[model samples]
Each structure stands twice: as C-alpha cells, then as structure tokens.
Target chain A: MKVLNEMSVNFESRSVNEAFARTAAAAFAAQLDPTVAELNEIRTAVSEAVTNCVVHAYRDTIGIISMNIRIAEGNILIVKIRDRGCGIEDIPRAMEPLFTTSPEDERAGLGFAVMQSFTDKLTVRSKPGKGTTVTLEKRLSPRLSDV
Target chain B: MLLKPKTMFDGKVLTVYLSGDIDHHSARRIREYTDALIGELKPVRLLLNYSAVSFMDSSGIGLIMGRYRMMKLYGGSVSVVSIPPALRKMMELSGLGCLDVLEGGNEENESA
Candidate 1:
C-alpha cells in the first residue's frame, strides 16, 4: 500500500498530553473527510494509546512520546504512537480486558481493549528496558461535505 | 474547554455533573474531588450526570467503576444520568451496564 501523506509529532510523556495526542490525531485524519463517528473513534483510540505511555510506560518518570500518522491507499488512516519508557513484559495479558498493572490509579485495564475495539487494526511491539510501540489503522469514509 | 466537574448535593443524593472531556488527566482530578465529597457527604445515592460530557475514552470506565466500588463499600448505590449514546456505548463495551443503573429512561426529578 502506497502512503499518501504522513506526519510525526513528539510530546512529553505527561498525563495532560493524552488530550493533545487525541486532538492531533483527529486533526490529521480530518483531511480524510471522515464522518463524525469515525473521527471520534480515531480520537478515542489515540487517547488510549497515548495514555498508556504516560501511565503505564513511564510510571514514575517523564519521557518522550512520538506519534506518527499516515494516510495509506487513500482510505486507510494509520497511526503509530511510540514511547521510550518501560516496556510491557506480557503483551497478551496487557491486551486483556480489565487487565491493568496500575490499579491504584483506578486504571480499568481497558486501554488496549478500547483501542482494539475502536480501530480496524491494532498492533503492539515492545521490549523490556526499551519501550513500546502501538500501531492502529482505520478505513475512513469520506465526508459528504468533502465529496 | 477547561476541565471541571460540577458537584451538587441534594440532601440524599450527590449529583456530579461533568462537562468538557474526560481523559486520564481530568479523570484523576475528578476522582479526587468526587472521592473527597463522597467521603464527607456520605450520601445515600450518587448520581453521575454525564449529559454535558463532550468526549470520553476508557479512562471514564475507571472513573465510573472506582466510584461504584466506593459507593458499594459505603452501603450506597451509584446511578449514571443522561449519558449520551456514544459515551453510553463505550461504557457498555466496558461492561458497566450490568454494574450500575444507566439513568434517563424514566423521568428524573433533580429536586426530589
């Protein structure tokens, strides 16, 4: 699949950045002319991925979070959020619904579950003492106004 | 919009009306404020009004679930009111419907 356009942004691993990441992803996907519902789903998925970086990845320290968004094959919106923080030990268990490592923060352990449910495709890669990367893809339908 | 949670206590029930967006950052603040109030007021019922909430992600699930657990421990119950369809769907996806009552189907009298 040939890529149409791509953009990358880096932000600090801060809890507040969760909203910024979501808005940035939504704004980038806006050019695709996605529907309101589609846009919302994309934002939510982005929020979950970024929040995971701030909460679980760099639990006690601050780090850098990189997000790359791309449009592929004219209709597929791909987003990759990467963090240089503590990597996941078990990917399968982390993806399970309500399986959270930080219960004191009231984390429902639904971050990965929500991302998987909202996006068309969700992938995660990580290494201990390194970091974690999450890639999400969604096929967008053009908005009527842009058509 | 700046994140803020509006809290009100109607003698028996403490109504928390949340506006703007609910994410990890704001959820923590909301949890702290609501937990303090719930602990002090000790209301028999807790009503969470999310009608004004514009955007919410999975962080909301933790917020609601934490409050539910808090109320349950106090021998009280929690009810969610005026949840928009999209947020309601997200909550349902997290299996919250089976735990707490989703208000709005019946008439709600805030003054009651």
Candidate 2:
C-alpha cells in the first residue's frame, strides 16, 4: 500500500488542546458506525489525558502542545500528542493511578490509567530534558468488514 | 458543527491540526475526518498536529496510534510534535514513545 501520512501544529497551553483531540477523534469515529458507548469512552479518555497536560504539564506558563492522529483502516486508529517543556523523570511513579506530581494542583494522576484502559494500545515516551508523547491505538469492535 | 476538519498540507505530507479536549465527546469526529483526508486528498503522507492541543487521555492516544498504523499501511509515516514536558515524560514512562514523536517541531526524526 502507498504509505507516509503526517501533520503538525504550533500551539500554546491556552489553545484548548483537549477540545481539539475530542473533536478530531469523534470525527474519526463517525466514519464507521461506532457504538454510542464506545464513542463516549474514547472521548472521555482524550479529555482526561489533555487535562493532565494542561493542569499539570504546562503549569502557569503558556507552552506549546502537539497532537497527531492516524487511521490505518476502518478498524484501527492512533492519536499522539507531545510537548517540550518539563520532562517527567519518573514515569512509573507518575503512572500510578493515584500518583499526582502536583497534589497542589489537585491532579488525580488517573489520566494515564484512563487512557490505557480506553485504547487497546497505549505508549508514552519522554526524556528528562526533552518532552513526552502519549500514543494510543485501538481496534474498533463490531467490525463491519470495510475500513 | 460537531467537527470541522482543518488541514495543513505539504506536497508530500498532510497534517491535521486539532484543538480543545479530545474525549468521549469527539473521538469519532477525528476518525471520520482522517478517513476522508486519506480517501480524498490521498497525500503521500499524513500527520496529526497536536501542538495547540492542551488535554488528551487514552482516547487521544487511540486516535494518534490508529493514524500511525494507517500511514504505515500506506507506506507513509506518522509523527507527533511539540508535546509538553510533563506530558512527554508520561508517555516515555508508559513506553508509548515507541512510535514517532518530534520535539518542539524541531523537524527531527522520532517515533512512538
């Protein structure tokens, strides 16, 4: 098959990245007759992840955020967002469902857990002085045969 | 309008820039727009621009990874850029960086 598809964005924390992610994912789901339940779950996961970044990632300063999405077929989809500001040195501690980097921010730290549950495949990468990217992949259920 | 797709394209690639929160309310929208772009524009490559994006959870990841696989199927590649620092570390700890992710639009090469 012909390959190579991509996109980019330059934005700051105030841009409402979570809203964008939801709209985009919902748009992608409409292509197939996604179940109402599935759609709801997906959108929630997106919001949770975005809120984490906005609430805890950027802090008080306005910073840049990037989100990328791909649909391989009618059955599977992928979405990833990355930013370079303050890297998370301890992922395990952070991924702990109840762990919050900033308790002062009232961050539940459940974002990662929720995202993991929603998507069939979830991956996160980062460097101390670099950035972090959250990648999620899912296989649509009740397949209709064409994607 | 439930979801309106806005795109940025280079002759060899196409990038869809999304904003706001990506949650149960909008995952499907992103999916449909992507399918249309791939079907109609038929660019040699496609990418999702998540820089301006502020929030996202697993549904967000689902959207990104799904697209990555899509581009891979066509032989093209998918990429993520400008992820915030704290969020970037989260992805790394989760091992989600196995794919393609770029820092600050550095135009460098990275993968999920």
Candidate 3:
C-alpha cells in the first residue's frame, strides 16, 4: 500500500481524550474526501478503539495513548490506537460480545464488536503486562461523482 | 465530554435530552444525573432524546442498558427517541432495539 499521508498523535489516557482522538483522526481522514457516512463510520470506529484504551488499558492511573493514521493507495484508511497499560489477559474472551471484565462498570463489552462492524479489518495485539495495540483499516469508496 | 443532559418532567413521563457524544467520561455523568432523577421522581416512563447526540460508541449501549435495568426495578420503561441513523445502527447492532423502545422524531408524550 502506497502511503500518501500519515500522522501520529500521543495523548494522556484520559476519558476526555476519547473525543479528541476521534476528531483528530476524522480530520486527517478528510483528505480522502469521504462522504459523511464514511467519515462517521471512521470516527465511530476510532472512538471505540480509543475509549478502550482510556477505560480498560489505563484503568484510573494515567498513561499514554497513541494513535496513528495513514492514508494508503485506493483511499484505504488505517488507524492504530496503542496504549502502554495493563494488557488483556484473555483476548478471545475480551472480544466476545457482552463479555466485559468490568461488568460492574456497566460496560456492555461491545467495543471490539463495534470496531469490527465499522471497519473492514480489525486486529488486536496485547501483552498481559506490556500494552495493547488495535489496528483498524477501511477502504473509503469515493462518491459516484468522484469516481 | 460535553454531557449536559436536560430533564423535563411531565407527570409520569420524564424526558431527558442528551447532547454531545456519549463515551466513558460523559456516560458517568449522564448515569449519575439520570440515576439521581430516577431515584427521586421514579417516573413510570423514561424517555431519552438523542436527537442532539452527535456520536456514541459502545459506552452508549452500557448507558442504555444500565438505565433500562434501573427503570425496570421501578416497573418503568425506557424509550429512546430521535436517534440519528449512525447511532441507531450502533444501538441496533448492540441489541438495544430489543431492550428499549426506539422511535423516530422528538414527539412529546401526550399522556405525560
């Protein structure tokens, strides 16, 4: 994939950063001239991934959350959200719908599911004590007029 | 994190107008605000107006589910209205359609 544009951002693991991350990524993705729905889909997927970092990864203690966005050939948008916090011990169980480690927190455990549904491809890699990285990619099909 | 949930009471129906995105941060405040109202007023029907909600992730699902459970304890029902299509899809995919009444437009309850 030939990268046309790319940018990376690092922010604190605060809940407020959730919106910031999503908006920043969306603005960067705007270069591809995606439609409103496509832009929203990208934003929503980024929101879920970033929220997971703020809520589950850091878990009260402040940490660093980084996000990288890259626009590749064919208007393919790639997003990577990474955090150096307590990693997931059970990846399979964590990805299961309605399976939340912090059920008491009222989490529906639908983060992964939402990401999967919004993006074309989703990948999660984590080390128990190291951190977790979520990679999401979506090919934004240009509007009929643009094509 | 702009979670300014405005509540209007009309007899048995309590309508809350939720604005901004519903993420982990704002969800806590929203939960607190609505839960306090539900605890005090105990309305028979709780209506959540999401017309102004621009973005909502899975945390929105948690908020809805939590409110649903809370309302259920008091034998009340929860309904979401004016949900944007983007959010409607999220709610639908999360199985929230089965948990609460989802309607179009922002019509005030005539029955109150």
Q: On TM-score, who's better, 1 or 3?
A: 1
Best by DockQ: 3
lDDT of 2 at A33: 58
Name the lDDT value of residue B85 in candidate 1: 70
Cα lDDT tens digits, model 3, B1-112, are 4535778998898999888888887899999989999999989999888888888888888998899898999999999888877786788888877764777654665223
Per-prediction share of native contacts kept? 0.76, 0.24, 0.86
Decreasing TM-score order of the candidates? 1, 3, 2
**Model 2 agreement with the true structure over A76-136: per-residue lDDT tens digits:** 6677777776668888887887576654432435677877877787887878767788887
RMSD of 3: 2.1
lDDT of 2 at B80: 70
Q: Which lDDT tens digits does candidate 3 get at residues A1-147?
A: 899889999999888888899999999998888888888888889988988888799997999999999999888999999999999999989999888878888999899998999999999999998999999999998656555
Cα deviation at A52, candidate 1, in Å, is 0.4
Stretches of candidate 2 exceeding 4 Å from the true structure: A1-10, A145-147, B1-112
Q: Give, for candidate 2 chain B, the lowest lDDT window spanning 10 residues.
A: B103-112
After best superposition, candidate 2 residue A112: deviation in angstroms? 0.7
**Candidate 1, residues A3-81: lDDT per residue as tens digits?**
9999999999988888899999999998888888888899999999999999988989999999999999858999999
DockQ of every candidate structure: 0.83, 0.10, 0.84
